[model samples]
Target: MGRHSLPDQYGAGASDPRRRARRRTVAIATVLVLAVAGGTAAAVRGGLLSFGSSCQDDPVRLTLAASPDLAPALESAAKRAREADLTSDGRCVAVTVSAREPYKVTDTLLAGKDPGAEVWVPDSEVWLQRLTATGGTADVSTVGHVASTPVGVAMEPTVAKSLGWPEKTYGWLELAGAALRDNSLRLGAADPARSATGLLALTRLSTAAAGVEGGDTQAAAMMKALSQRISDSDGQVLDTLPRDSSGTEQGNPRRNQALVVSEQAAYAYNTAADGDRSLDFFYPKDGSPRLDYPYALLEQTGLTTDQSRAAIRFMSYLDDPPQRRLLERHGFRTSDDEVPDALVAGAGGSGPQPYAEPAARPASAVALQETLGVWTITVQSARITTVVDASASMSEPVPGSGRSRMDVTKAALQRALATFTAEDEIGLWDFSTKLDGAKDYRVLVPTERLGDRKGTGTQRDRLSAAFGDLAPVPNGATGLYDTTLAAYRAATGSYAEGKFNALVILTDGRNEDPGSVSRADLVAQLERLTNPERPVPLIMIAVGPDADREEANRIAEATGGSGHEVSDPSQIQSVILKAIVEAASRDGQG
Candidate 1:
């Protein structure tokens, strides 16, 4: 259940069906045995299918997909439920728990399919927001948290002693920045794009860093450093910690003296480790974000009424005294307002440390999007080709702001450009009728690394100048269809693997050029150019009232892309970031 749980083991191999059948039979047997003291052994010892069994055969069997960290505890709880003869409406209830990655499960649920589970227990509420944000047709409802764990810096005891852990306190920014400068403390974290713990911790760190004078630079520097040691998931981050007392694994560069991990993870490690361990933790003075394990029901699929009731019944059963004890033993807080002394101490905390402080505020969708965008640019750098419309409609000024759509959009783009690092590859293009003699689009910059050398300066410099120079043609008509096809073709040709590859189109109107390719032909060409092995998701931003959002969405979907609307072009960067985060997630998960 902890690290032993595999990511994609839900509904595993040929034995899955057999396992379910066995569980049904065992459920019936367990109910029958409760009627008599020795019927269980008597029936099993005799190898009896049934000894004049009068057992009413209806049973509620449910599959619960839970985060790997909580699966072991839930499995134990399920076994206890069965032993107690727990039932819903006179039918014996049984639950089969499968360990799964929350991100992958969220992707599956949003795709409007059964994720091989009737109920899902993801590690945080953020996953719910992510699932619902897509406007998914599936009806997955939250049933509240089963357990929780706070995220903080977990360090080896020696390192903690040097930092005055038990006596002195530190904020996220202070500790994280100090780690960046000090060579002794090798800091590591899970990729924020994937792990909630990482994202929450990074958000807190970012917030703290921003309050200072030179915050932007500091935050970017810290993220770049952390990326060198970032793990794909929370469990893998645990793997990066030092295993022995010496704490000197010179051969392994991945080994870390400190990490950003949840209290439950620290507790798990401390329980198994020797005296010298990474149990020493520092709960920052500012605040720590908690992973609230929400028990959500996947009611969109084959969830029967009985199965739903049985799931609810099991949820209640988890609140029982024994179940509570089980959760406590595994180092989880059932309530957010209350802090468990034993659990915190086990994860290495003391009275002076601000362990009981109120948690950090819950992150909003916008904050999450912006933070993830920062990651995509700085650490998980992307390959983006931005195509802007130069039609005459774009020349009109925005209602509230005096600036034209092109002006606000260019400023927003330049700001966005600063977020990206040298590792990122970006290109620029502008389009309208007769913009490139006969062609509808003209490439302002070729797709290449921002770090690469251009004429005098770098690619980033060339891109910045191009963005500033963008202007709308006086009498030009929209050539959106042709531009989309051309940009997508070039983007696919210059695809960079292991990066968030994308084509961004900013337009104020639909295709108005009679010579342009038909929408159907453009979509087909985009679809053909979109390689599953090397995907290039086109992000189309309809910048003003005149743009056709439906058409943008239709074309974007053909290349596994997304469409967004920006009444105020000032919000384009935020929209692009959110879209990029979604696209990157799909790329990794697929």
Candidate 2:
């Protein structure tokens, strides 16, 4: 109104056409500009824009439970993930890796009640599938493969040569025959409950022993035979390795012990063995099981700030080429990429090591079922002898420790005795002046009377009482070799068909009664008694400062069993459990 200098005769009669058109155009232009600006702002607010001004601040932390078998590779992969910065929110992520048995880990991961981890890498894919099959609201996704290797008999070249290697594929029968027949041959594998690799190996052996094509017999006779050889429980096995390796090699060749290990470990060991050549790999002729390391993503357990970042980062890093190369250098095959030539050359001096089958063997559903069935049926027929060294030396307290060696040995044996089901045949042998009670070392009772099949409290109470009553008897020098002979003789007298036989020998000192029963003589006797057709395995547990390493090795070597040396009383239960696990199951599945 104030600037109406051009008020033409457009007032009430007619409108200014150009003015109206210009006004309408201005309104349309304003609307168009607002729509464009708001859309642009919305895009920015919604995070669809190309440039982001801010990011999540907190770091993600991932807790990973991995099978002990793949601990090495996963550890290396974890290191690379952090370096590559492939995290979920551009923040640093921390990965905490814990190594445990594949079965235990899978069971724990599947239960999913506690604050769960962000990821789990088991030694076998079968575990992953088994975990998922156990119904749950959570969805644990299987990440890309990690590493693979076939189970092999780890032995010295000389031993392998004696067993007829290179010229023929080494089957479990040959190994079993050697272990049972020869007094010098030594064989060892981890407790099935403690190691996926060990379990796979046992499973293969059980299948071969039963002549079951593609089926794992849980109750197979071979399983019982194998189980009888485990000297300690799962926890104890881990500790025993270091204990047995105690005291540096310094001019002592007997200090070196051979173990059936993963391919990567074998490679590392071979590289370090130098001129000693004490360690070598033995691929079983019965077609070894492929190790399909499965890294599964745990979805339900809310990740820590760092875990979320680590989970995404680790996966992305493994998918990258350069990081994959590092894994290969460490004797691992990448799941998504080709095996590096260097790795191939390292494996076999030429091409990649060809397994009996492909690395990614499917977890057979029928095979698993058959194996489980066999385990339930066959577990009971095994006869177990718990050998305890009640020699005077066991009464002496461990130097700088609280409990006596005898007490610790009893605790371990008690724990092992508790794991036996009713169907099993069990007996007890206390070696001192002579084998206790059972007239000249005989079976105490059929295990069925001990407890219910469901593993009830009744059995626990009976075992506890039996273990508690073991008084520390002050006797003459520990007669390990003699005690072993007496026990074996007693076992052969009443040995049953279709039954697994084992002697669990616990000692705390050297075998000093060499005048009448020398170690060499005892070993020869054991060889004759444990003839391949009637294999009777022996497991030994050495306790106290004076425990003879050489003697323990002799017994284990002669019997195809495992021997363990213990210093810590707390770890006894684990050691005994592993031995029982080894004796009860075949091919590690049981």
The alpha-carbon RMSD values of the candidates against the true structure, listed in the order shown, are: 8.2, 22.5
Off by over 4 Å in 2: 1-57, 89-94, 110-112, 132-138, 212-221, 231-260, 272-277, 303-313, 335-363, 372-590
In candidate 1, stretches whose alpha carbon ends up further than 4 angstroms from where it belongs are 1-59, 209-218, 247-252, 377-380, 452-458, 527-530
- Candidate 1's TM-score: 0.83
Q: Which of the numbered candidates is closest to the native, going by highest TM-score?
A: 1
In model 1, what lDDT does residue 264 have?
91
Residue 271 displacement (Å), model 2: 3.7
lDDT tens readout by residue for model 2, 219-283: 24345544444434333332222232323532232221334455655655555444354344555
What's the lDDT of the predicted structure labeled candidate 2? Answer: 0.55
Worst 10 residues of 1 by lDDT: 1-10
How does each model score on lDDT?
0.83, 0.55
Candidate 2 Cα deviation (angstroms), residue 439: 40
lDDT score for candidate 1 against the true structure: 0.83
Give me candidate 2's TM-score against the actual structure.
Answer: 0.49
Model 2 weakest lDDT span, ten residues long? 1-10
Candidate 1 on 1-590: residue-level lDDT in tens?
11112123211211245655776798677757755775666656675545554223545899999999999999999887776556666566778999998877887878776799999999988788877666667688786678888899998777788888799989999999778886768999998877889988988887887688768657877888888999999999988876666746733666887899998999988887876664798998899888988888998877888787778777877766678789989988876577779899889878698888877788787777788878876876788999999888888999989989889999999868867777888889999998888999999898889889956999988999999999999999998888899889888888886888899999989899998889999999888888999988999999889887898999999988999888999999889988887787777668
